[model samples]
Target: MILEPKMIEEVQAAVQEAKCLGVRGQGTKPALAMAWGETAVLSTRHLSGILAYEPNEYTFTAYAGTAVSEVITTLAQNNQYLPFDPLWVEAGATLGGTVAANASGSGRYRYGGVRDFILGVSFVDGSGQLVRGGGKVVKNSAGFDIPKFMVGSLGRYGILVELTFKVFPKPRSYVTLQLQYASLHAALFAMFKLAVMPFEMDVLDLAPELAGKATLIIRLGGLPEALPGRVERMRGFLQEQTEVETAVLLENEADITYWQAQNRFDWAFAASQLVKIPVTPKQIPTLDKHLTNTLRRYSAGGNVAWVAADDMTALQTTLTELNLAGLQFTGHTDDPYLGSRKGRRFAQRIKKALDPNAVFSTND
Candidate 1:
């Protein structure tokens, strides 16, 4: 409970001794990985700061406990960004914890997810021995993508200490546009069209609660003049083809606030069980019908569904009926969080091979 390990040696000792280790930056996504009681907790508050950054080479290496805010601030000094738009910025979050949880936000739509950006990692494995995987540079003929494997593992394999990521230069400007549609079918169809087209949206999300009304927010970043042309093109395409009742362009201070709300949904469900269900684009309708009673908010252009509900039985049954993966966030031990691994036997075997000791201290 009294976890404030500052040094790497302390981290190794804590990880080796505890039955399970819960590493957290800011506790932003408390529902991310359930805490197995009677375990050692490693707080990355002390292990914070940017270790190195090179603007020309497009690379940044920082300690695990480094606040994403600090990283962004430092990156901004050089006009750079993480591109992934890591969440929980207000709290003291760390780079290592972020990679361990594999938590990504909507900005990931442009380049990719955390898994795509993280180039290397340093961790204290189950044996308390420090192991470094991958290289500091952007390109490397590494043995394998060890960093990617660590992602979404949720601190089950080891205690991630230091992280190295490829960075991108920040854009000149940004614009947010709200495109309205008369119905879900129309909005989603228009969204699908925009997705396939050759354009990059800062974030694209749909809020379809009011019957016969849907709101699709499209974000664009670039030189100021270029944004209007793109927005006009998007507006013309939607207005001419799709049934658009109206369209609104939100900018300056208002746009920032709107995107903030759209981005920070994970923290909203601190007390409830936050379940992430991955479904195909075609399954949204089925999901809308099946999980109607449950409080649901979607992100990543509707590819990921976040459901906060206290009832595990109903959630599992609905997900099972739809033949989808229902990853539970919080619940009694009787019901597993990751609903079904369908074909994860191989993954289980791989975990066994890597850690070998079955790191009893991790939250797999």
Candidate 2:
């Protein structure tokens, strides 16, 4: 059964009556939502709209079910945007779903992720109570940081009813440089070199190419007139300091479309499973060796891995062998978690405190 709640009181009542409930927004991630088994799915579709927006203060509050696309459009009109670049917006991802999934895109490389921008949240707890945390303003720092805790919580703690986020002025212009390297080692070396420099890169991503080669994708955002010089300087730096084979610069509509494709996961459309794994650059070389047949991309300077694979069992085995954990977003599975588990003990403690009745899914 599915329940669509249109208000806080409705959400509270739904939680109060349901034996076990799974929360969702638009159902963009069906695998993760369905992991709750036979529970009634609580859809936040009807509970939508922006509540408040303060352009001067750079903050906005909206219903949890508010479409991320709407938020982006509204912010664009104000010459501002969410710097973390919430992902899956074009795919009908809701503000609440993005927060619950912690789905930030490549832009997170500069400003940080979903947890960094979220200032406040209102949710219905397991006991059918409405709870508010943090503040609508940005200077808030008085509570238990329940807002941050709700990030990536996947409704295990509470069902987010509304959220407030801090945004930044949108950059006037943007450019992307795609640098090719003969090998992953060379590309990684270039990434390390670029990381230390003050390039102020807005995005740094890596992807493997044929024959063990790799491509380093970098994005820069700033004044329109100043972008050309900056792009040349970046190209010159890589050419002189690293073993970069070639560089392709994208601008205007091309640059916009490229990133949109990435944010939409267009390249991984053929894969049956899409999983996100937190990783460091140092661990990527070893991890890459095992993902021979999978499609993967490294974002945030190799701080995160998005993997698309057809063989779920094989991927799970590889992650387990490497002592890594992954959260699946697509495909079927009894559990969305794969490989070695982490933070279970602490998560369980929080779950007990927030949802003692076990009304919500136990997964994090």
Candidate 3:
């Protein structure tokens, strides 16, 4: 693992000499979409520090290696936050890894993902040059929007060394409401129906284990006065439609823990294949039905499904049959990644320009 020093020249040399740049924040996400064979990992831990913060402008810039926790803390102190709450608690995940992996917790359902929060970024391209994209402010649209393209690039594009995000003010109060359903089908249906209403959700997830049955966890973030009534109205409508016998009101911390587990691939699906499938909400049902025994968790918020299993070939075939693609998270030695959009010609172009030598992980 490469721990980058603060000096720009040091970063340049490391990128120049490395055969493949495995950019990692805390090595928390190494298993998913990883590259082996003569690859050198870049740990941004040492390059860490907050470069700038302008709360008034809702903007903050930090080194890529800066811990996601640190940034959230700073934002909180200012009564603000990275609205797209990133999920890297135990892994010491960095800002770069969050963007590289495009990993965000359930809170993403409210506003958007890292793609929506990222205003700009700084990086050392394959050529080992220090470069910057997007302005430091919130409203600037000066040149091409390269930062977003790098948001979910998974390090195949360029090595992200620093980032700038347009932060959001913290909510006054947050409340979580969970509804127990007899099955995932029912819970998912309730979630999709609620998504269209005039509601603000910090998180929405389904937990079938402890519930002894499937359940959908819906979290609301807003002012204190508004929470009780909002929860009541939502509850009435949900109960009228589904077989929800229980509506558990979880405290703030409890809600956070539930969503983080999903974001970090926790709760012990260890050493198995963790595949991500992206499709429209309607397609989720069809795809979920195809998984013979692979336990599934569909992030109805992001239209991303997490499939866990010990088999890889079957996962690939199933995904292909459904006309979907996924990034291989964890699995056997030679598991195949479902890969990018078949016609992502523009993605290839961006990857070429940022990593002309294809110095990062090459799924191709």
Best by lDDT: 2
Best by the TM-score measure: 2
TM-score of each: 0.89, 0.97, 0.89
lDDT of 3 by residue, 1-364 (tens): 5445676678788888877776666667656434455357766677888999998999988988788888888888889987776876566888888888787766777788888989888888888888788765534366567788677777677778888889888987788787888776787788778878777667776655433356687888888898989999888888787779677897668866655666677753787777667767777667766663666666646376777767677777777787788876555444246743564787788778778887776555
lDDT of each: 0.71, 0.89, 0.74
| Candidate 2 residue 357 C-alpha distance from true site, Å | 1.2
Could you tell me how far off, in angstroms, the CA of residue 68 lies in candidate 1 after the best superposition? 0.6
The TM-score that candidate 1 achieves is 0.89
lDDT digits (tens) for residues 60-173 of candidate 2: 999999999999999999999999988878888999999998888999999899999999999999999998888844334564688898898988999999999999999989
Note the residue pairs that clash in candidate 1.
Answer: 19-361, 20-361, 328-337
lDDT of 3 at 13: 88
Q: lDDT (0-100) at residue 195 of candidate 3? A: 76
lDDT of 1 by residue, 1-364 (tens): 7477778898888767766566666565565534566455677768777788888988888888888888888889888888887865656556876786666776776777898888888887777789787775434355567788778766666777888889888878888887778776778888888888777787776656535466777888888778889888888877776788777888777877766665566434556676777766677777777655556655577777767766777777777777787655443443335555564675566656656676533434
Candidate 1 segments exceeding 4 Å error: 136-143, 210-212, 266-272, 328-336, 360-364
Error of 3 at 82 (Å): 1.4
List residue ranges in candidate 3 displaced over 4 A. Answer: 1-3, 136-143, 207-213, 260-262, 300-302, 330-336, 339-344
